[model samples]
Target: MAGPWITEHEVSVVEDAMRNGWYEHAYDYCEKFQAEFAVYHDRQYGLMTPNCTTAIHLLLAGLGVGPGDEVILPECTWIASGAGVTYQGATPVFADIDPNHWCIDPESVEKLISPKTKAMIVVDLFGNMPDMDALQAVADKHGIFLIEDSAEALGSVYKGTRAGKFGIGSVFSFHRTKTLTCGEGGMLLLDDKELYERCSMLRDHGRRPGGPAYFNEEVTFKYMPFNVQAALAYAQFQRIDELVGKKQEQLNQYREKLSDIDDLQLNPEPEGGINGAWISAVVFGKSHNMSKHKAIEELEKLDIPARPFFYPLSSLPAYGEMIDEYKTRNSIAYDISERGINLPGAANLTGEQIDKVCDGIHRILT
Candidate 1:
């Protein structure tokens, strides 16, 4: 699907970047994407990174979130969200999620905050934005940093505000599977100039911000986004409305076809803002007596590429030692992970393809 969207403009942009030579200067091309992306999200600045993981890592480091600090995270998210906190030598506290939207519950977040808590990484998973307005108020009252991991949600909005605009720093991913693709890339959106400057330095081997190049100030990885990818990303960004619309259409097809099946929970569009995402997901009810694994296996046999939702943080072996501290008893996240499956909602997936996918699900469930 990503392949179909590649226009000649992206190729020409890459070629132009190549002719100019990235070594001598990359800021010209990269900065254009960053600036344009910031404007799109209504953020003050945007810093491009190698990926969202690195974006969150740099965000944590820039904000001085480190050893002995604690960052509360939604229990069900890509491991990167928790790893970002781990990289800073901080504890990753886990909390339950709201069953309806599968986003971190604000009340759960408030309960987890303590003197050691410095921030909360709210994941807008599968294009669903949580109650950021409620969560932001909690953060403001407690003075904890609110970080939005909108890596899976690019154009998703809640209460008329863009996903990444609610926090001190928010991340967006442009991985091949993401709504926008640059093969692999990320963007950090924020309002603070000082924080932005720190992120810039951390992204480029700790150079003293600005640049004549080759002035290393401290130890940092090469997290900078390449101009070539940036060019490709900007090209994809140009067609965002078309891409989002196509996904929403595909989602509609899934719901219209599958919604009649009793005991099958399809993705819900809780109206507050434009929840026009097309993330085709289904959670099997207790009566179905089928595990998500079995559904995925059956889908694969039919060549229907389905993905499982993330295992709750406590459910995974990686977070074994901290289970007692972070685990919430009878977590809804764990229940959702056990039952949910994500079908292919590729930006370029054809109506025929979506139909086949839905037909396969209907056959399996019945």
Candidate 2:
């Protein structure tokens, strides 16, 4: 992956972190970023974590979802989504995705909800929000939490509302690959102070902050993010709008450059939402002579990096037990996973670079 986009501010804060001491008690860069980020998403609380996966784990733990309970999630997400559920010893029931947006289908999510279901993990994959209105309605009817795994969607929006605000809580990844990068960090966004406090305590060894001296309330994971990482996040967060706009420019470039390629199709923009412009992905026509793997290999040979979409949960060995269970139920996810190709859409990429990448694809196919 490419390095994170950083300005002089990140460098200065990191230098100050070293001089002032990262272990200093009064240090507040991390907290500052957390507060700013929370406001950016219109949430009341935000807690930074070491990574998105651990954030999910802590969120699930805080919500009291564990053994014998179930969390419904789309079958075509990064493995970390399922890993989070497994961490709680809860079953991750797979749901099909809408073929157009490649996000969890609300109807499929409703079908998967059982008495044992505790929540629905809706992933805004590729920076697109699923039909949150519909998904939230199902969650309300079932009295289950709607947890948005918005790891790939930081600045996206749906029907005028921010992407992370639709669900009761949302998680964002600040990994280098994301539009906003801190090199490595994650944030949990929510309006519920009780759940926020619960997750905050769970994030840092079950200790509740009592003035400067904290108390150990219960047993929990030690998954706190470093102030150093948050400093980087602060720097990147400042340029979030520019970063998102740059990628949107790249998205437009890719759409224009590859419009004539009948066998290669770009993902659809959300009907009433904005994309975070994470990665410009395409789904190759099934009749193409070049397989997805072959296409990736070809792109590699031309010095253009490309990646296949995540393998559907039904096909992964890690979820073999659930594979058979989800095989018939998640056909759309399976089909989309096999065909989707994630093209590079980094902000620093230039128009020439995008054209070169698209040209490489055209040459490989022709």
Residue 84 displacement (Å), model 2: 1.7
Give the candidate number with the greatest lDDT: 1
lDDT of 1 at 332: 83
Q: List TM-scores for all candidates, in order.
A: 0.94, 0.95
lDDT of 1 by residue, 141-234 (tens): 9999999998987778888887788889999888887777888899999899999988888888898666768888889867988888888888
Could you tell me how far off, in angstroms, the CA of residue 113 lies in candidate 2 after the best superposition?
1.2
- What lDDT does candidate 1 reach at residue 133? 83
**Model 2: per-residue lDDT, tens digit, 219-305?**
889988787778778878888888788767777788898898886667567777788767778888877766668889988999998
Question: Which candidate number has the best TM-score?
Answer: 2
Worst 10 residues of 2 by lDDT: 18-27
Clashing pairs in 1: none
